[model samples]
Target: MNNKNINRETIIKFNPSQLVNLPVFLLGMILIPGLCLLDDLIKLYLPSGFIPEEIELYIRNLPVYLALLYAIYLGYQILKISCIRYEISPEEFRYYSGILSRKHEFIENYRVKDFSINRPLIYRLFGLGNLTIYTSDKTTPVFKMEAISNPQDIYKTLRGLVEQNRRAKHVFEVD
Candidate 1:
């Protein structure tokens, strides 16, 4: 593409939805209670002296420990999702990710081979979808934009950009 046609301005920028962590959150909710119940069952069925006091104490506090760990994990999941950012310009797609360290990736628009959108039942309720881009870029052959809003519109815009970029770059896919 000629320098005159280059547009560095970002056309679309988005971060994945926090709702993607729903399953992990639900599992933690169920697991903590289940662990407490199991501890109670063990106490009720076993003789008082059958298990050592230290072991008994550990069993009794297992749920609290697990809950703390789960909380940390959930926080990490939220942070990880928040750190991911995607940007699409007319010429290329940019992906930014990392919690402690930042990583930036780019795929030229002309390199995009195909696109697919997946809207799961849960995601559909929230008007969110996952967009997968199949690209010729070797660094990232398949890129997924998970749990983003208004994916259909983005898909259409990207499809047009890809066509335009390919024509400008004189790139033709044989297959």
Candidate 2:
């Protein structure tokens, strides 16, 4: 047994994928444009004077929904900083998060197999990328490790780590 001195270490890192509250983003993207397009249509039916009753009702309702979605997006963005942290202990690589309730996932190093990178069109244009990790057990999935960032470097780093662990295990078996 070797004391690698790699126990109970914490790495506080945040990534852009965390910002991807897809439903919230989608709501904003869809509704704002939709409302704009509906603007003329809304006006058309809006009794051409001090805003029709139905139009006023519709417009009034939009703010509450939009406000709710915006609040969710804002919360995700703001909460990203406090909750985004990963800890690499001697036995487990753990992920920690929570806005209301704390969350964590701790997996042993030997179980990680492959690391992959993915980039959405916007991220690609911005020169940012994403990282995913596949495991040896095939139970856990390739998760978006670090969100929008330089994908190449992270991919290489994680890949190297997984490979290094596998090689070490292989050497021990041979001995």
Candidate 3:
């Protein structure tokens, strides 16, 4: 008999930490073979033997180089995802992120009004979402979380706090 239950804290991500595009990867895979086909086609078409065969060969090989360059570009684009981490405590919710330069933001619990989820078609298809937060403070963000995962849960949690603050009448960020 085996019975196991592990209790873990709720980890919320308002955005995706990594990028994934199966189609782009697949396109690169297909392009690898297509380069050879295109090179052969160019070789067959560059007629008359007037130009040096070496020059023709170089021209024919250009597609392979182009395909390799495009693959590199795709890799760079897909690698642009930045990680977002949020820690929600009784006092404040803190957000932190940086692929290079670290940035941190803290929002007091009481000033929060509500949070809305934005799931455009691209996000929905790709399993990504954003959280837009409403707060009393004039700070930009109006509270925005991007590329986060499990946004619906974060939205619900933030919304629940609005009513909780209402009952407590707590004032946050007095400055």
Candidate closest to the true structure, highest lDDT: 1
Pick the winner on lDDT between candidates 1 and 3: 1
The CA lDDT at 42 in model 1 is 67
Model 3 CA deviation exceeding 4 Å by range: 1-41, 46-58, 120-129, 136-139, 162-169, 172-175
Candidate 1, clashing residue pairs? none
TM-score of 3: 0.55
What TM-score would each prediction reach against the true structure?
Answer: 0.85, 0.59, 0.55
lDDT of candidate 1 over 30-120, digit per residue (tens): 9888878877786677667778999878776776787788889999999999999888888898999999999999999999999999999
Better of 1 and 2 by lDDT: 1
lDDT of 2 by residue, 9-55 (tens): 43223345544555556666777777666665655665545878777
Model 2 misplaced stretches (Cα beyond 4 Å): 1-14, 17-26, 29-82, 87-92, 171-175
The Cα local distance difference test for each model comes to: 0.87, 0.60, 0.65
Writing each residue's lDDT as its tens digit, candidate 3 over 1-175 gives 1112322222333445343454577787898788878887877887757779878667867997788798787866565444456766544667776656777887766778667788877677766787787777566449776656667876676566555655676444444
The true-versus-predicted C-alpha distance at residue 128 of model 2, in Å, is: 2.1
